[model samples]
Target chain A: MNLFQYVRPAEQKTAIAAVAAEPTARFLGGGTNLLDLMKRHIMQPEKLVDVTRLPLKGITQQGNIIRIGALTRNTEIAEDKTILQNLPLLAMAINAGASAQIRNMATTGGNLLQRTRCPYFYDTAMPCNKREPGTGCGALEGFNRMHAIFGFSDKCIAVNPSDMNVALRALDATVVVNGPKGERKIPIADFHRLPGDTPEKDTNLDKNELITAVTIPISPFSKNAYYLKVRDRNSYAFALVSVAAALNMDGNTIKEARLAMGGVAHKPWRLTDAETFLKSKTATEENFQQAAQIAFQGAKAFKHNQYKLKLGPNTIVQALSVASGLKSV
Target chain B: MNEQEPFCPNESRRSFLKKSTVITAVALTPAAAINAANNHWDEHIAAAIENVSLSVEINGTRHTMDIDPRTSLLDLLRENLHLTGTKKGCDYGQCGACTVHVNGERVLSCLTLAATTDGSKVTTIEGLANGDELHPMQAAFIKHDGFQCGYCTPGQIMSAVACIREGHASSRDQIREYMSGNICRCGAYPNIVDAIEEVQKGGQKV
Candidate 1:
């Protein structure tokens, strides 16, 4: 990593001002992703405003929403009694994403802002539009087993490899960001952007905005939610196809449902159509299969990811089945 | 302007004033001043001027040192403090060979910048023993043959201790899940899990 100036601002205002004043400066939270990117020379910030000590680490519950500070470590959130009880899906998704060591070092904001794990993007020598705009996507014609299957443009086919973000989208979380222009709350659905002409930008956040907290509204599906991540390995691997399924059941019928998928799109692909189709339907294998089919209506696969067309639906059905208490695996 | 003199006084004074003006501008912005000093000056001088002083307690020893802001906790331990017990397998956060405890939580040292860990208590494998007595996890590792080549033993023991302390070592599957970060190349996972289970069941203070 290149030698850079580090300033740990004790105040949030100071940290926001530092980032706003310097375009090349970045806020250092847990240093899990940023430092790794820096070591690979993928990102080279001239200055790092250390925001780790800026009073942004807490997990609180208000009347109908749970506010989680952005700097809260993944392990803390995953193990917090309130989060585990209130948002079990979030906890399960976080635990499934990384290992214990990484979970200890990775923060909530950093995890949401993590870069794609595409090999082409990490190579730095390869031609990746996500890494360098207008350079052309290497995965479009190269090895793309881990590329996206939905919401992918010809310019880029990378997927957001975050399990937590998938659950947050399903829970309808809101991201609170502090910037030079004061504060703004962005819905989790609109937080991450699809890789269109500009694959270089992964999020809807501005360069100067610093994420302070994420608030998740209380949902009735907390009792019937599951985060199923399928990977090549049993643990410590990014998901090949993951599903976040939550159902609000009235007796044996689904009253409401929220579904989102990861490792299949540039952002957390929310299955609004599938969610609508599952409502008022009996929680059964057939209904889940139909919903899964609806979820993959527009999914397009790449050269080496055709199996996702099959695996994605299978995983969704299994997740829905397990989440609705119809079956357990 | 005496061209033959090779040093025009007017041009020299003008360049000096321009350089001074730039320096004055840099000085006004401390962040820019630090970057300017790092880029335009000698690296050693830049490091000396830009490196932040960190007073950290590691392995029960309190030491004060100056380190580059970019220096990782792993590099600071191995390179600066010469604590090689904490190995650096990947230098990234993937491998858990550089695992250590900061405030009693097992974190990837390579992913932690030393400058960010100011005033925090750090504990490495070297600090796991009570002088002559080995930590319970270390002893259990030997009893259960938890490793082959032992390159990942220290990290495994450190994580095992934390896994038990964190209440994630209740079952074999739980131990395996929590200890997934520390990879053993020789496939000593079965024994590692056995060792962790024994340590957990023994009710010994880790």
Candidate 2:
């Protein structure tokens, strides 16, 4: 890692100003991903503004709404009583994402901002458009079994590796960020952007903006929600095709459904069409299969990931079955 | 102690400190060990090394040192303080061989910046034993034969102790899930689970 200047600003405005002053400056949260990137010489920042010591480190509730500080560690969010009781899908997704050690050290904002686990992106020897624009995407023709199947442009096909972001997207969370211009609220859907021409930009966040907290509402789908992560290993592995399925059931019928998928798109792929199809339908395997089919309508698989076409629908069906309590979790 | 001169090479000093610190690290506080590192050294090894002031307590010994802003906690423990008990496996947080307790929570020291650990209490494998008496978790590992090569033992033991304390060791599955951070290339997972169970059975000892 390059020797850089470190600053721990006590105030939020100071932190924002510090990053804005230096074009190569970055806000360091837990430094799990940033430090690793620095070690590999992927990201060389001149100044790192440590945000861990700031006053953004807790989970608060107002009535039925919960506000999670961006600095709140993933372990704390997973183990929080209110989160477990109200938004259980978020907790389950957080647990299914990374190992206990990483979850213990990684923060909420850092997890959302984590780079993709694409091998080409990590290997500096390879040509990665995300790492360096106009370098050509190596993952396009290389080993792309883990690449994206939705919302992918020709520039890049890397999928977002954040389980927390998928759950947040499914839960209808809003991200609150502070910048030099002013504080603004960004909906969870718009927080992360697809890889258009600028594959370097992962989210819609400005370089000067600092993520403060995320707000998730206590929805009716809390009672029946499940995060099903399909991976090579049972634990500590990135998702192959995971689903965050939640259902608001009215007896044997579904009142509403919230569905978002990970490891299949540039961003969290929210299955809004499948969700609409599942509304008012009886909780059955046939209906779930139809909904899964609807979710995969435009999903196009790469050369090595043809199996995802089959596995994706199966996972969606299984996750829906588990969320509606038709199958045991 | 002049590092720029030809007489005081870093290797000889490091070897002497390693040989001499076997007793001082345990018999006395390891503050002197770091002091020896500070008193005889060259901080200007590279042009990029901008020394940052950091005050951290490791193994119950408080030591203030001027470290490079790029220095990781694992590098500081092994290279500066000569605390090599915490092994470096992958060094990129992929392997948990650098596991240590930061503020009583199990974290990958390789990923943690030493400068960020200011005013924080860190515990390594060297601090698990009390005098000659081994910690209950350490003893349980031996009794259950939790390791074969012992390369990943330190990280596994540290993570195991934390798993039991965090109330995540209630069942064998829970132990496996919580201890998933530590990877044993030797595949001693079943025995490690047994060791954790024994330590969990014997309450308030870890």
Candidate 3:
């Protein structure tokens, strides 16, 4: 790690100003990913503006929406009574992502902005277009078992490694960002960008913008939602092909549905087609299987990750079954 | 100003002043120096070690010291404060060997920067015991034989204490899931779970 100046801005204005003034400055949330990347010499921010102290730690419900402050820790979000009752899918997805220790240290904003867990990005010796644009992508031709199978660019095949983002995308959440200009709300679907030619830019957030909160609208999928993750280990591992399924059922028929997948693409891969297909359909194994097939319409797999073609659908079917009460949790 | 007496034996006074000016500029403000370094200012490497004042309370004892901003909480505890019980396994967040409590929440000390923890309270493995008396979690670990090589026991016990307190220890599966952060190469997971279960069942305050 390199020696850098540390600034803890108590006010949001101060924090935003500090980040805007310095091109090499980064906002420190939980410091789980940023610090790890710093120790690996992957990112060398000249100054770390610690925003943990900013007044953005609230988790409240305003009528039909649940607003989660950007600095709220993952553990708190997972165990909060309101979230557990209203957004159980988000709680489950967050709980399934990391261990308790990490959950304690990781904030909602930090989790959403977390970089890829691609090995090539971690190892500076290797070439990663995301880590260093024009360096060439090592995972495209190298050991890419964890690489993406959807929305992959020729420059990068890395997957977004956040379970919480997938749930947020499915919930149709909105990200509240504060910047030099003012505040703006970005729909969660457009928050994270696919690895196009510019894989360096993870989210749609501008350099001067700082995430303040995330708001999710009240929905009927509260009671019937599941976050199913299949990993190498049962816990404390990134998802290989995780599914976040939520169904608003009209008795036996699906009134509405939301589906998103992790470990599949550069961003949270929302299954808009699958979600549309699931509406008005009977919540059964066959319908879920058909929806899963629709979800993988344009999914292109790498050499080592071809198994995701099978596992992805299976996980989706299982998640749908669990969420719809067809299968036991 | 002293042209006759050179600061260095071989260097000229004018060159020495130029070098000293650069060093002084870097020492006074590191952001400019970092910018210079980013632009390949290799000569100012000596002035890059920026020191920051940190006031932290550890194990109920408060210490105010100047530390390099790059120093991790784990390194500060083990190297600076001599609290070595908090082991460093992977030196990254992957291994829980550096697990410690920050404001009563278990966090990987290795990933936590000392500068970021200013005015915060931390509890390490060394602080588990109350003078002569062992914490219930520590005693339970001993009674249940929760470790073999004992390298990862400190982190396991710390995490177990947190897991129980956080209400994640209601069942064996939950304990396993919560304590998954601490990896035991010796495979003493069953015994570790037993320790946590006994402590949770005993109703002793952790």
Candidate 4:
């Protein structure tokens, strides 16, 4: 849209080399989000290395883990037999994202690389610290209904809009990346960064980096996992507050628990405190309510997102109840 | 093992088979005529689009076009190519206003780049008809009155064609879920679902 050059490389190596050669170049995946942002001039890349055609699409199960290729469509990932059986929570999270057509076109890698849907980030006329450091954060004093409630700085308050990343983090997935340096794998929790001092940096990934695949270790707890997303609309919108929960119940007591919150923090919020408290505890409504409170203990809320503080715990309780194979409280 | 069955001459059986074949062939003449007419329409179109070199097979017929890559597949068919049946609503993917089959899969023609789909088959609303006759789904839509504005008819029809093809026309809930991407701002969803149900009831054929 900006009169840029395009290349559809048949191989990933050539595509990587092309991106490395060009200073202002970006890899194009499904183009659902990237192209839209680029057309708005929010993202300006001189070259678009079309990696959609490169043979990087599939979902495979190796032993107790599931490996998802970077270019696998969200719909495909959500509908994969293995994912549906072993990682039902991940599949459910993928299904909870965008509409069918968008999901059909959006890739796993593209979903991970999706920029914040912050109104300030989209509007070039406004000053966004994420778009331009030291400019200002228009969202801080402006409309911040969709902004983060925790792990945010004064410079940026936008919440990460992914539904699958939360489930991936809870399942302790690994993000495999490839670049000029070499290939390396990072834990999914460390894949994204919080808006600490540098709000502009969304992830530790360098500009030249390319995500190859995401490997998820299968957990016995995941068999009972569930993902619940609460949004203003029934479909085609980002989550207001969502929870990914997996719990193992031995009769009435919680054997183990994995929980993560979305739309409440700069990145996926893993509830280690609540999970630690839930282990070996009686899986009752009272226990779930107490655990939910523990999950929200350290949460810092803004004026607009204080509703999430209440909704966050309620969402966690409901998700945990469902994951524990119990009725909603 | 009966002597009468053995005595039944092979000549009579051959004659009966021949007569049935003739009758069946005669009954299929109208459909054959429609197919021939469609072929004639394609050739006539080829004569008009001399400069357009697009090797696209629509509903199954190859045509080479020497046209603008900036011209969207919807525009190429409706405006330049004179297949003005695929309606253009929003010119964006969100509205599902220009949905069509690209390589047997439903895609928003408005958002799709024409150059990127080189050598791909495309199907438009016009291709769904059999000469003067309509496809079963089209007849069902008319019978059930699936549109009010009639502006979103082409896209609705195209999406419906894909809906049936993609095996999503099983239940009312399934139809609603699959057709959620295609919007009829005229608020004719109930009748649209009724039409889809009617066609799907008789075992829809694409």
Candidate 5:
């Protein structure tokens, strides 16, 4: 890594200004992704504004909403009593993603902003529009085994690698951020952006804007929530097709449902249509299969990831089956 | 820029005299320090220009070093202070060979910036034992043969200790799940889980 300026600002605004002052500067969180990116020569920041000193590490609940500070470590959030009790889907998803050591170091805010695991994006030698625009996407034609099955453009076939994000989208969480302009709340769905023509932009968050916290309204699906991840391995691997399925059940009928899938799109692929279809329907394997089919209506698969076309529905049905208590976990 | 705390350097096993003299020279006079650091003048100068003051208590000894802000805690242990027991398997978070306890929580040292650990307490594999006496987890690893080639042993031990402490070692499957971060390329996972289970079952403080 090249030599660069590093500043540890104590306050949130000071940290924001330090990053805003230098266009090439970036905010340093847990440094799990940023440091690795820098070492790989994929990202080169002239200055790093360290925000670890900022007092933004806590989980607070107000009435029905729970607010998690930006710097709260993944392990902290996963193991918190209230989170496991109320938002167990988030806990299950976070725990399912990485190992315990990584979860200990990774922060909640940093997890949301993690880049794609697409091999092309990590390999600078490859032509990746996400790395450098107009470079041409190597994954689009090259071995796209881990590429997207939805929300992909002709320019990029990468997928967001965060399992935490998939659960957050299902819970309808809101991301609170502070920038030079002011503070604003972005719903989790809007927080991450699809790699449209501009594959370089991963999120709707502007430059120098710091994520302060994430708030989630008390969920109704806590009793019947499940995060099912299918990966190359049973443990310590990214999901090939993961589902965060939650249901509000009235006996055997589904009062409501929130569903999202990971490793299939540039963002957490929220199955709004599937969720809409499952409402008032009986919670059964046949209904889940139908919902799963509806969720993948617009999903487009690549050459190597055609297995996802089959794996995707299986994962969705499995998640919904377990979450609805039609089948055991 | 503040009072440097010294937590009893009277019994340092790694020649605290020479290290403290070098630290004093570096903090007081750059000319003498540069001469002392002649081998790494390039990194020293660059890091000196944007020096971030970091004071960390490692294994009971306090060290305040000027580091390149990008210097990871793994690099700090292996390079700066010569405490190389903590292995750097992947140099990234993927492999947990750089596992260390930061304020009693196990974290990947390779992913942790030295500057970010300024006021924190760090414990590496080198610090697990009390002088010559091994920790309970270490003894259990020996009894159960938890490693082969021993490259990933240090990180596995650190993470194992943490797994038990975090109450994640309740079952064999849970131990494997929690310790998945520390990958043993030699495939000593079954024995590793046995060792952790023994330590947990023995009810020994790690």
Candidate 6:
């Protein structure tokens, strides 16, 4: 392992300055993902600024929305009463990710920044555009089952592997970033970027910019939300496919709907087309089937991930139906 | 940067010196003091970039060390201080192999840097034994055959203790959920659950 300097800045300014001074410097949160990547040489920083000690480590409520600090542990959020009651989708999403021990150590921000578990990305020996752009994407042909289906360029096919972000996108949450320019907000849906031509850039946040907090908008919509994750294992595994849906029904007609998908795109895919189609439609089996089909309208699929084209819609429909108190076939 | 109360060093060399002044006078005869100072420096330079002083109370014992800022609590314990009971399975927090108690709450030691845990109470597997007696959870693991190969046992035990503390030991499902982090590839989960259940039930079978 390469040796590096470590600084535990007592103040946030000093920590930011440390990163600004050395662009290769990284802020260490729970180190659940960062240290692992560092050990694998997937990420190597010349300096590590310990950010766990910073005062940005709490979950607070502003009106009906819950603003979670970047440093708040996944375990804390999963167990918080406010999150469980108001945003059960967030709680369910957090619980589905990682294991209990990992949840105890992983911070909210780290989860958002988690890299894909694509074998090609992790094994530097393999050609992965996400890991090293223009090298070519090996997973485009090899083991492409777990790769992306919606936002795939010729260069990369790796999916954005975050259940929490998928849930946040559906709820229309916003990320508060503190960077060289000071405080700014990015809607969660726009926080992560698609792999348009450069798969290397996973997010819009520059290298020096730090995610300060994630603020979910105040809404009663989340009260009827559900996060459904389908994976190979019952525990300690990443999602093969997952859905986050918030459905509000009036009698039998859908009053409102928000849907987002995971394990299917470069970033969380919010099915806005499906939402618009379902708004005034009855929440019956036929209407749900049509809306579900609308969600996957322009989703381009790879050879192996064609199954996700079906699984994605089915997963969303199942979650939405359950949340809407309708029978899921 | 602010002054948090530093815990007095436990019954190690520092505490021994603190308790017995007459013994320290004889024990710190030139050669011993020089050797003691050297040992201190060796521990301090484990990661060796900046001298980060910390007071961590392990088990019931307080230990003061000037650790390297890069030192993880797991590395500080296993690599530098020789508390090897906490295993480093994945080195990542994905596996619960390096679980330990931070202020009586279960935390992944591998993810925690020693500097971040300054003045916090840490309890490792080595500290779970009281002199010649083992902690009830430790004894339960042995009785129930909770391990085969024994790589993840220490972490499993540490997590089990925390599970009981966190009140998840009563239900089978909750125990499974809470202990889901610690994976035993050998598939000894049944025995591990049995052990945790025994410990939760007052550590003695009726």
Candidate 1 chain A minimal-lDDT segment of 10 residues: A1-10
Clashes of each: 0, 0, 0, 7, 0, 0
Which candidate has the highest DockQ of all?
Answer: 3
Q: Report the error of model 1 at residue B92, Å.
A: 0.9
Poorest 10 consecutive residues of model 2 chain A by lDDT? A1-10
Q: What is the DockQ of candidate 4?
A: 0.04
Tens-place lDDT per residue, model 1, A199-252, is 999999999899999999889989999999999999999999999999998999
State the DockQ, from 0 to 1, for candidate 5.
0.32
- Chain A TM-score of prediction number 3: 0.99
TM-score of model 4 relative to the true fold?
0.82
> How would the docking of model 5 be graded?
acceptable
RMSD of 6: 8.3
Which runs of model 1 end up more than 4 angstroms from their true locations?
Answer: B1-41
Question: What TM-score does the first chain of candidate 5 have?
Answer: 0.99
Two-way TM-score contest, 1 vs 6, winner: 1
Taking the tens digit of each residue's C-alpha lDDT, what string does model 3 give over A100-177?
899999999999999865999998999998888999999988998998999999999989999999999999999999
Which residue pairs show backbone clashes in model 3?
Answer: none
lDDT digits (tens) for residues A17-113 of candidate 6:
8788775778888787777777677876767777776778788897777899998889898888878878888888888888777777788888888
lDDT of 2 at A137: 94
| Candidate 4 local lDDT, A1-329, one digit each (tens) | 43344555667787888788777778877676776676567776656676766667899999998899999989889888888888999988987887666676678898888875588998899999898889999999988888888788898999899998999989999999999999999898898998877888888888888898999988887567889999996666689999999987778778899999889888888999999999999878789999999988878877687788889899988888888878742
**Candidate 2 CAPRI assessment class:** acceptable
Evaluate chain B of model 5: give its TM-score.
0.78
Question: In candidate 2, what are the lDDT values of residues B10-100, reduced to their tens digit?
Answer: 3444445446634334332222332333344322322112356678899999989877777899999999999999999999998899999
Q: On a 0 to 100 scale, what is the lDDT of residue B14 in model 6?
A: 44
DockQ scores for all predicted structures: 0.32, 0.26, 0.34, 0.04, 0.32, 0.23
Q: For residues A265-313, what per-residue lDDT tens digits would candidate 2 score against the true structure?
A: 9899899999999999999999999999999999998899999999999
Put down candidate 5 lDDT per residue, A1-329, tens digits, no spaces: 75566677667888889788877789888888999998887887767887766778889999999999999999889989989999999999999988998888788889999986588988889999999999999998899998899989999989998999999999999999999999999999999988889989999999889999999999889999999999998899888889999999999999999999999999998999999999999998999999999999988888899999999999999999999888998
Model 3 Cα lDDT, one tens digit per residue, B126-164: 888999999999999999999999999999989999999
What is the C-alpha lDDT profile of model 1 across B48-158, one tens digit per residue? 445677778999898888777778999999999899999888888887988999989999999999987788889999999999899999999999999999998888889
lDDT of 4 by residue, B1-206 (tens): 01111111133433453356433442322223223333453322222211123456766777665553235677777776777777787664667777777776677776564534556778878788899999898898899999998888877887787788767789998888777777888899899999998888888576
